[model samples]
Target: MPYINIKITREGVTAEQKARLIAGATQLLVDVLGKNPATTVVVIDEVDTDNWGIAGEQVTRRRERGR
Candidate 1:
């Protein structure tokens, strides 16, 4: 079994987009690793910008500075 974890900022991602991400990850394992789709697991984690950070700053602050 293959376990894939995906994390993204919780910025109003649509259900369809999440579904596509899961499907794409599963398909990638199936295509590249020859893993069974039924045995593949994909988890999507949506985190608040404040909880996610980059370059010594929170994502929320980064976005604010960019704007």
Candidate 2:
């Protein structure tokens, strides 16, 4: 079994998009490593922008700067 964890900012991500992500990740593992899709596990975690940081700046602040 393969476990894939994906983390992203808590932006407005649609359910369809998340479904696509899960399917795509499972397919990638199947194609690349011959893993069984039935046994693969994919988990997505959505974090607050304030909790995610880059280059010492919070993602929330970074987006604020861009706006």
Top model number, lDDT: 2
> All models: lDDT?
0.95, 0.96
Model 1: per-residue Cα lDDT over 1-67, one tens digit each: 9999999999999999999999999999999989999989999999999999888889999889883
How well does candidate 1 score on lDDT at residue 18?
Answer: 97
TM-score (C-alpha) between model 2 and the true structure: 0.96
Tens-digit lDDT track of model 2 for 5-64: 999999999999999999999999999999999999999999999999989989999998
Clash-forming residue pairs, model 1: none
Best by TM-score: 2
lDDT of candidate 2 at residue 36, scale 0 to 100: 94
Model 1 regions more than 4 Å off:
none
Q: Candidate 2 overall Cα lDDT vs. reference?
A: 0.96
